[model samples]
Structures are given as C-alpha cells and as structure tokens.
Target: MIATRDAYGEALAKLGEENDNIVVLDADLSGSTKTSLFAKKFPERFFNMGIAEANMIGTAAGLAAAGKIPFASTFAIFAVGRAWEQVRQSVAYPKANVKIVATHSGITVGEDGGSHQSVEDIAIMRAVPNMTVIVPADGIETALAVKAAADFKGPVYVRLGRNKVPTIFDDTYKFEIGKGVMLRPGTDITFIGTGLMTAQALVAADLLQAEGISARVIHIATIKPLDEEIILAAARETGAIVTAEEHSIIGGLGGAVSELLSEKCPTKLKRVGIKDRFGLSGKGDELLKYFGLLPENLVEAAKEILAEK
Candidate 1:
C-alpha cells in the first residue's frame, strides 16, 4: 500500500530527469503534499512559493508561458479555494502547461476539520474550461497520471489524498486520460468509483460476489472529459449504477455520472460520499465510515439499487 501523493512526488522527480523544462512550485506545504521529493532531486528547478497560493499559481503560469511545465503543489483547499481566481485567469484561461497537483484532499485529510478538507475542488476545477481533472485510484495510477499530465498540454488538476491506500493496480495497468477501466465484470449492477473509492469498489464487488450480486466495477481516474462511452455501456449492461468518491455527492464523480446517465440512459443510481455537509476532525478510516464510504456502504447501496431495479 502507498499514498498516491508519494507516487506523484517520485514520478515528478523522475520526469524531471527526462525533461529539463519541468519545474515545481509549492506554497510552503511541500512536505505535506510530498513535492519535497522532487525538490530534493531538482532543487534548482524547484521554487518555494511561500504561503501565497495565488502567487504560486501566477508564477507557475509565467513559467508555463516560458516553455516550462510547472507543477504547483499545495493543500487541496488552498490550491483550489485560495488561488481559484489565478488558476482560472492565469493558467486555465491561457491554456498554460501547468499541473496543479493538490494533496490532502477530501475527508481523509483527517483531523484537520472542514477548513482543511477539500470536498468541492473537483467540482470547481471541472467547471473550468481547458482544465483536465484527474483522480488516480492508487500509487501506480498516480505515477501514470503524473507522467500523463507532464506530457499533455494545457492546464490540469490532479487531486490526491493524505492517507495510505491499498495498491489496486499493478505495473501492467495502462492508464488513459478520460478513460475508465473496468476492474470487474458483472450483469446486475455497476459500481462506478473514483480515487481511493475505486479500491473500495473492488472490495465491495468481492462482498457482492459472495451474495451472487455480480457487481461490475469501473474505475474513473479522469473526472473531466469523462469516458461517456464506457459509463453509458455500464449503465446499459447493468441497468443500475452506484457512484462512489471521497468528495461530495453534489458535483464530484457522482454528479458527473448522474449528468451523463440522465441525458444518455437514465438508469437507477445512488451516490456514496459525504452528503451536503462539512467534514470534521477524525481519523481517516473513521471519517470514511462516518460518511458511509466503506465497502459495506457500497455493498448496501448496490443492493438498494438492485432492489429498485
């Protein structure tokens, strides 16, 4: 098991070796965001942007305009909430080659309370034009995503969490931007999950299998420009859908899937995430359970959708 941010830091350092134009900027949270690994390897290319999140974003945009791939790192809340105007006006609007890889996202931020936790970052970033949003499932996926973000042009936002999670994908796993991977096949219901919840979806699939539920698990690593083809296929095949994420049920993965299915298929759907409420200080695992984001909750949601079907 490994934290996705750890993989991201390692991947950024490795990418720096191959691409000299790759630079890193952090708003005084390199250690928390794990960008310190990259700073250690490429100190000259790393810029400590102090506590000014907006300034860090503007500097990254300037670096991008000068032909550098600037990776801006900070807490998710600060990156999206504090520096949103700069991100929208400087980086995203100009389609700059900037990667905003924010860590410590969601209720899993743990003990930091609602102010530190970022439940709406995904929604707001996805709303920006020319901005690609990604939520990798595991360390392997995170590494691939970092590489993908470096290679892809324009603005990108990659959301990562603080807690260590189960390694769901192997080295053989290939990640494609805006594509969803079907981890398990089923005919009864589809469990569409993103970020760490994708790992939970796999576990929930096992629990359902024992009960002959036949749940299909689809991991959505890319939230923006969603894999509509794959999602529609799952909805058509399974007839019922359950979307899970570590963020809010409003405009994260659940909202994206709900929008797609409503327009394309209109399948029975349930969302597993923090309802319209703020996160509180607690242990990471405890927070997940408190918000009903565990495998048992997913299994129950699947059963409910099945019952309705």
Candidate 2:
C-alpha cells in the first residue's frame, strides 16, 4: 500500500484546505493523475483544462502572477514534453509559485507504453533555470514534498509513481528537499537511486548483506539541486558507486551523479537504466523486469561494481 501518487493527491487536497492561496489545475487527467479527489472536495479552486497541458501551465502562471499558489497536474510525459515550453517560459523563467505534480512517471505507466511513459522528464525539468525537481520515494515523502512546494515561491516539479509497494519509512523519515537520505551503512560501495529505484536499491542492499557485501543505500529524492556533499562523502568512503534509475541512462539521476562525480570526486561508477529504447504495452512490473530494474539485476550490478573495485 505504498502508492505515493495517492498521497500526493490527498496532500494537495489537505494543503488546499489549510492554505487559501493554493489552487489546483489538471489537464483533463484528474482520474489517472489522482487529482480528481482534490477536484471533488475543492470544486471552486480546482480547474480542469481539458487535456491541454500547455494551457494548464499558462493558466497556472497567471494564477501565480495574481498572488495565488497554483499546482498543475498531469502525466509525466505531458508535463515534460507537451508542456515543456510553457513550463520553461511561464514558470521557470519568472520563477513562479507553480507546483507541477506529475504522476505515473517512468515506465510505471506500464501498458500505456512509451507514449505515456516519461523517462526524460526529470532531466528536462532540471535543466530549466529555477526549477526544483523532486522524486519522492514513497507516500510520506510525496505528502511532505507537496506540502513544502506550496511554501517555496518558485516552480517545483514533484515526480511520483503509480505502483503499490512497501512502506520503507516508519512514518518518521524527515524528507528535506535537496537532502539525500542515507538508509544503510556500507563501505564497499554506495548504491544511489531515485524514485522507484530507491526501493530496489534497499532490497538489493539487504541481499548483499548475506554475501558479506556492505553497500550503502542513498535515496536521492531531490534531483535538480543535487545534494553534492552527501554524494561526495559516500563516494569518498565507498570508492565505488552504482546508480539505479527508472529513466534512461542519458540524463536523469544517473547523469546528475556522473556529472558531479566526474568533476568533483572521479569515483568508479556504474549506471543501470533504459538504453535509449521506447517502452511498449505491458504491465508496470513487466516493464521494470524487462528494463533490468529488478532486485536480481541490482544485485548483479553491485557484484560487478565490487569486482572492479
């Protein structure tokens, strides 16, 4: 029952009640994106833009200009692709108080395939100036990020998945934006993952324990303004790093880490993700298993990284 998407929708509705300045807009995907719950409660504050992501983004910008905090919801693909220019021009450039809540990110959209899947959303969003990108690990983090974004006076992109996984936190994990959470202690290697892959890294670390392999699991929820100090410390201690992401190997968390490590620490690193391929119709888990995001795949990657070390 670890659906962060559900928590995001619920948090938005709750946050709306507390903050009168908060407003919500969806691109005709209130049901799938889970913003319908907010619409049902705060009908006057919620706006449905009828499948037009670009228009929704522009509308959000106008709301922000008028001293209102607007949250726009849509699929990850649409938020990053269809509404990219609008996001860049209206939200990021001016640094508006617009929160972009994108659901079903990565291949978790499953049977909807590549068209609906968003592997490059983070990279694109992060590259924009003044955009804060967040990939919450579970429901709690999602709720926390949603609540925090309303306070921050800038464009924030929060990514959440659709699948139901295990609740890794004890309802006490402090999810601070731009801070990475270290879940396990290890010296041999550092396993860095974001979004859904963070859970995989945790499970992989447990499997590595039986083999006497000490691998640290670092949950990188914030992607844009990366926590470089934490990453550098882990790299300095472990000497080897393995990155797991549900995005392409090009420019997501893997790219962010590689960029920092190459210039800062020059640590040995291995990246696991999609290799510039599009997904097709299939269940969520099937795509993950196919894309080498399974626990077995992570264990194998860790073994390979350790071998090099």
Model 1 residue-pair collision total: 0
Give the Å error, residue 302, model 2: 1.3
Model 1 per-residue lDDT tens digits across residues 255-279: 9999999998999999998898889
Q: What is the lDDT of candidate 2?
A: 0.89
Q: On residues 150-248, what C-alpha lDDT tens digit does candidate 2 reach at each position? A: 888799999988888667777777778899989899999999999878889999998999899999999999998899999999999999999988888
lDDT of each: 0.94, 0.89
Q: Which candidate number maximizes lDDT?
A: 1
- TM-score, cand. 1 vs. native: 0.99
Worst 10 residues of 2 by lDDT: 165-174
